[model samples]
Target: MAEIIEDFLVKKDQGYYCAYGDFYIDPLYPVQQAVVSHAHGDHASPGHQAIYCTEATAAFMQIRYAKQALSSYQVKDFEQKFHLNGVDILFYPAGHILGSAQILMIYQGVRYLYTGDYKLQEDNTCEPIKIVEADVLITETTFADPNVKHPDPKEEILKLAVASNIMLGCYSLGKAQRITALLNQYLPEKEILVHHSMLAFHRIYDKFNEVPMKYELYNRKSMKGDEKNKVYLIPPLTFNSYRRAKNVLRVFASGWARLQASNDLSLYLSDHVDWEDILTFVKQVKPRAIWTLHGDGRQLHAHLSDDLIIRDIFTQTYRPDFC
Candidate 1:
């Protein structure tokens, strides 16, 4: 069991540990020291003794856990090399959501890149992704299957422009703001009725200029045909409860459309690298070894030669991406 762990990171009872840095990476439970990758619920939780992450990620956490506060935190600017203990650390743009980052840790002359929930595609709602070179690459293979392909967001958002009204189901934090910004860019003429759950995140993104677009709050009960030609950005959880009107098209924005058929019209939008982009990223990063996290990596194994070392953490505990 000990031999199965990555050299740079040990799989501990609490989380992925780095003895050199004396900290955990995305710990499942709060710990004394943490090197957080982002503010998504699963990755960033309250009560950590201390955290090192991007400035935006810290701010988002304050909002996410409004009533609570972490013991302490240090903000790491993108691409700025910093030292924690004897280890060198750097954070890079991930393009998945506001303040999403890929962390690079260098110790003992070896470099390891941990991509904490990333997408290579362009997103106006957050900083664009930047490729990093390292000896070992830890990737999120959420859509690693050969068949998974995400349609261009602009093309999918354009479909809403032609519709009289849209009940768009998406993750409240990342997906909602992403689609909102896309609409602001391509369908600026149309009004967006955003759910209350997603409004705070939109404001947070706007506060950082991560999302410069504008939208209105949604009041589903009071909505009439008066709010025509609008897109109501609601939480994916509420997709079933959303009542459809004659002109309103009920749609779910997700990568699930690529893998399976859905009862509602699927937008096929995702804040994750598709199969082609995954292959492209691997080639560009050019790591000696690859560690897969958050999703299956069978697609990578099938294409990459047998000489490379590839470990999929999902083989232990597969879970959904916390958007």
Candidate 2:
């Protein structure tokens, strides 16, 4: 049976270090060489000497970090093979966000796939997941418990149909664009208003979409009852900062129950794969061994049979510094 090559990628104080490639995958702090999996702040950091990622990821990182963006970017297309420190590396679409990627490293004939925040659910705002087989699968277990099953996103989006005036709390980057597209598609009657902070991200995503999304910038004038149905999409922080708003239904879209409890309506929407999706992906990829990060993996270990090797990388010792 295949096992984790400890020396290949060791858990360092900063992040996951690959001695073979001389790089860190989604490092928490600045490093000499970072192979960033996506544009998410937690995964992508500033002050890296050099970054290797997809073109879209580079764009998003630049927009997010501004002046702090990396000095040099070795941007590449998906599925294109590039040699880095004697290892063959390829970026596969992770389906988590617009520029999210699953980094694949092939060294000495053994393949290792690092899945950085992936989902099997259909999302029109970004590229869908492209599953590839590997000897070792290092995946994010954000929702890998047997009890958590994410509801259909389309169905969850429809929950706002009844509320004429709605305030949606979403993450500014990926979640904002997704909710905007869903509102435009399923709830066409609603006038989508995007927060100014998220407008740049929406505009960036628009460049990659076949048809541009429809949204107006959020303003106090629009919040007035001039429009019949209005949905204002704001980031979670902004949503919570408000003390109260008149005649508006407050809702936050997330898989976590705590966020849903704070809002007037529950919208169980998430970009991460649920337990069933994880199981389906595991079956499709047919990995020899599995290593999980990002969340608790005790349930996954207990549910899967002994034939499958399951290891949790985010235990006490190997935990990431960012968290």
Q: Against the unseen true structure, what C-alpha lDDT does each candidate score?
A: 0.78, 0.86
Per-residue lDDT of 118-229 in model 2, one digit per residue for the tens? 9999999999999999988898899988889999998999998985688888999899999989989998888899999999999999998897999999887988865658
Off by over 4 Å in 2: 1-4, 69-71, 314-323
Top-scoring candidate (lDDT): 2
* Local error of candidate 1 at residue 79 (angstroms): 2.0
**Quick one: best TM-score, which candidate?**
2
Predicted structure 1: lDDT: 0.78
**Cα TM-score of candidate 2:** 0.94
Candidate 1 global Cα RMSD:
4.6
